[model samples]
Target: MKQRPAVDLSELPTFGHGPRTPTWWGTLAFMALEGMGFAIAAGSYLYLAYLTPQRPLSAPTPNHWPGTIVTLLLLASLVPNHILKRHAEACEMLPVRIGLVVMSLLGIAPLVVRWFEFPALNIYWDTNAYGSMLWVMLGLHTAHLITDVGDTLVLTALMFTRHANSGRRFADVGDNVFYWDFVVVTWIPIYLLIYWMPRLD
Candidate 1:
């Protein structure tokens, strides 16, 4: 009589990046929830605009310069972001470290510009519904931007320490890159709704 030998799991990797990881799925769920929130906010803005056919915003058209700058910066960051993802996926420690630092700088740049963006909206949050919605949209994205930047900074710091070599760390970097892309993508429609919608009149 022959008996089947037990399977050995010891040789299998304990962690993985991308879809092979729980972190990846968690990131996807987080993005989906955040996306829903953004959709709801944008829907509200559209509803208000529909109610006011003559002048959707009923406020001065916002200065598009600050937002446009932010848009361009976020778009530009995609280049470095893809580079970082490549390094992370390859588990190339040196380039991942450098990429983290570069990404940290890129993350902060738009936040600094966003300081001016709030004012460039040409209305206060408390002024009225239109202004309130505008701020809500921007505020939502800003919150995400700040959170992701902090995550990047922390990860950058971690990559300089002993833990930098862990395979899980590379996965974390991939997640960070994924979230950063989400932050950038969500802002586009919000930017248009807040700035251009007012000018439609």
Candidate 2:
């Protein structure tokens, strides 16, 4: 058997921030698939609207207030989200922990607002296809929001433990930040679709 040339493995980093690591790519892949789901859902809504232009067979235009509040809150979340991202990238444990706590709270605030959003829709899931689509879109985004919040809370707890010093955990925080941005960005269009689309008619 021929021997391969010697190579040093000691300097290889076990964790990296941002897209340099596998987890970041995995996070991106997840976001891409979820984004596709949103695209398809939005397309279906538009198609239904197109078919019923004269009277969109849907409920009356929903109250835009709650959705508007949630959108503003989501947009506001970006500030802390990016701050957390910066701390995570720098592998700074103190700021990272603080950011995690802030993020956890941020996650919960929108969820609270989300409860009001369903009622603001002024439609029930079983009412008709329009109602069903509306609920489906909201439910899908809420599921993602809940999931990310849960993840953030868990990570926050873990950061308080002895494992806080791990570089991998910082990378995990970075990934969480990345995912939350996706969660927030995806909501903008859905909010418009659910609340504003009916007004255009």
Candidate 3:
């Protein structure tokens, strides 16, 4: 038999280096699209508000207490999520597990509260222009949150299985966290518009 050369694992790159870490370009592109969506929605709301002189049909308007609490929960998730990304980059398992658990809890809590709020508010999609805008905006954001939770879960599993020890894992975690951050940050303006602005006017 002819002798064959042995392959050395050390010779291979620890991680593929072509725009590592979730591809910044891809993340930016997605963010751009999301931003445009939010902008258009906000514009529509403002246009409708301007046309409607009545401004909030009833007094003692919808209480924003629930939304505020949800917002706080979502905002709090950012810290642990960021820490998880950092720990992943350092190839530390403990912090990554802790961070993932925290992030998942943070992401899921707001969604549950949101579901509860919908019924208590006793509003419909066509209740008024405000209702329509509120549903669409919150619905869109909620969709993003659902996706984020799924992504985080996948990452968590990878970490648990020791499949994320590759150099690329850091990039993956970083990328997911970046998108998750965008999802939360984007909600701030929408929250202000939907919950606070109505009360002020």
Whole-model Cα lDDT of every candidate shown, in order: 0.92, 0.90, 0.77
lDDT string, candidate 1, 58-144, tens digits: 667889999999999999999999999999999999999999999999999999999999999888999989888889999999999
Per-residue lDDT of 100 in model 3? 81
Each prediction's total of clashing residue pairs, residues at least 3 apart in sequence or on different chains, is 0, 0, 1
Which scores greater on lDDT, model 1 or model 2? 1
Which ranges of candidate 3 are over 4 A from the true structure?
Answer: 1-13, 16-22, 57-60, 120-122
Instruction: State which candidate, 2 or 3, has the greater lDDT.
Output: 2
Clashes of 1: 0
Could you tell me the lDDT of residue 176 within candidate 1? 96
lDDT for position 85 in model 3: 74
Candidate 3: C-alpha RMSD after superposition: 4.8
Model 2 per-residue lDDT tens digits across residues 48-138? 8888876447467889998888888889989999999998888888998999998898899989989998988888989999988999999
User: Evaluated with lDDT, which candidate comes out highest?
Assistant: 1
Best by TM-score: 1
- CA lDDT of 185 in candidate 3? 90
